[model samples]
Target: MTINIIDHFNEYFEMVPAISDELKLEVYKLRYQVYCIENLFLNPGHYPDNLEVDDFDPQSVHYLIRHRKSGEYAATTRLILPGTDNPEKLFPLELYCEIDNSGVMQPINREHLGEVSRFCVSKEFKKRKNETHTLAAIGPDQQDYFTSDERRAFPLISLALIACVIKVSHENDIRYLYATMERSLLQFLSALGINFIKIGPQGDYHGPRWPTVIKITDLLDCVAEKKPNIWNFLTNEGSFGQTRPIEKPSKAVRSNSWVGT
Candidate 1:
């Protein structure tokens, strides 16, 4: 049976905005598991509470992909928006890697820029033998949740995270996104028409990572042309086709704005 990727994804997983403190903690804990314990890309000692967090988190919007059946958060990602108080503040990529100013990076608007950071999937969700050591490989135990055909759609988790990034960025009026990504991940995304331009040479950060950038409009256009299904999934049926600026909320209102499932 040919699976409808979007329907299959929605049936088994949920894209939740980590808007509340409790949900944000869930995002941090998942990051701690992936970054600190599993990958050792970060030192567990640095996060005594076992929650992986950083300075940019204060200016970021977090999202989690939850496995509906198990009620476990299978993956998490964050979009680090520009600082409200200091729009000129440097992103992590700026501090860690040298960006190429000669080409596509020259016209970036700082006020509308955001970075995709700490994107990871829990080990339990990674399903292939070769992917065991990577950030998103699934375990044998998770196999019971799906039939063989359904299992083929497992890679949607990564796409779902990208969808989250697109949604949040649109809501916040963010146009450009920066990320330091592994080559394999970049290739995977590129194949799906989600191209991110390499703006700098590879740098050693947790591992060899290439600094990249993508304009949200350009990405959407590419995906829509080459892979309409994926574009539909990412844009939620064209809802994010236009920028919809979300009003600034008071601290209290923001805290109560969303509840993750």
Candidate 2:
């Protein structure tokens, strides 16, 4: 399960670790904005704090991306190392099983795995036009046309977010990854070269529709093999990835289970 550290550096846009409190807050606030404000899960939850963080924070390393020139925080993602602070060693897998009794998503014995989650970008930074041009160095799918700063930004948010996590995963020696995502997002992930193994059929998401849980180590594999620019930033690049590595989640996770069987 070894990944090449130099594979994820972005030639056009330099990747940096979001280590400062201000930058981390920026990342946290963005999560709050996207998750709480946008409600991307296709269903709503009581996420009381309005902050998109969970217990995973304590055990994960966070990273941010900035334009090579201006050094602005355009995107962000966090990676939870296997057996670090993560109790489950995966993102919400236990919750997923509870949400859809349709099939088993495996228990959290957590062997060799890492969890990628809570990725987002500031709406203000994402709407800028220049962010789109960096695509050439990132490798192929710029499907996030981002025709307008407003419309185009949403999809880039996901792409950059995925890129952000990949950088962290490569450096930490983590090869396997896990996630519970929206079913409709499958097409979008495919365009970014993300590979997924869908676990079960649609069942319920607590209220409206069912969200899917998928495994994605294959996607990380491609990022390492294809994107050299991204890989550069991850190796020896300073700031974001270097954290004090906490074992407890900076905050507690949602105790509420996912939608029912």
lDDT: worst 10-residue window of model 1? 249-258
Q: After superposition, how far is residue 61 of candidate 1 from its true place, in Å?
A: 0.4
- Residue 225 Cα positional deviation in candidate 2, in Å, after optimal superposition: 9.1
Q: Of the candidates shown, which would achieve the greatest lDDT relative to the real structure?
A: 1
Write model 2 residue lDDT over 25-92, tens digit each, in one string.
76676566655564454222555555566676767777765544355555667876665543454355
Q: Which ranges in model 1 have alpha carbons more than 4 Å from their true place? A: 136-146, 242-261
- The 10-residue segment of model 2 with minimum total lDDT is 252-261
Candidate-wise lDDT, in order = 0.79, 0.47
Task: Say which candidate scores most in TM-score.
Answer: 1
Question: Against the hidden reference, what TM-scores do the models get?
Answer: 0.87, 0.54
- The whole-model C-alpha lDDT of candidate 1 against the native structure comes to 0.79
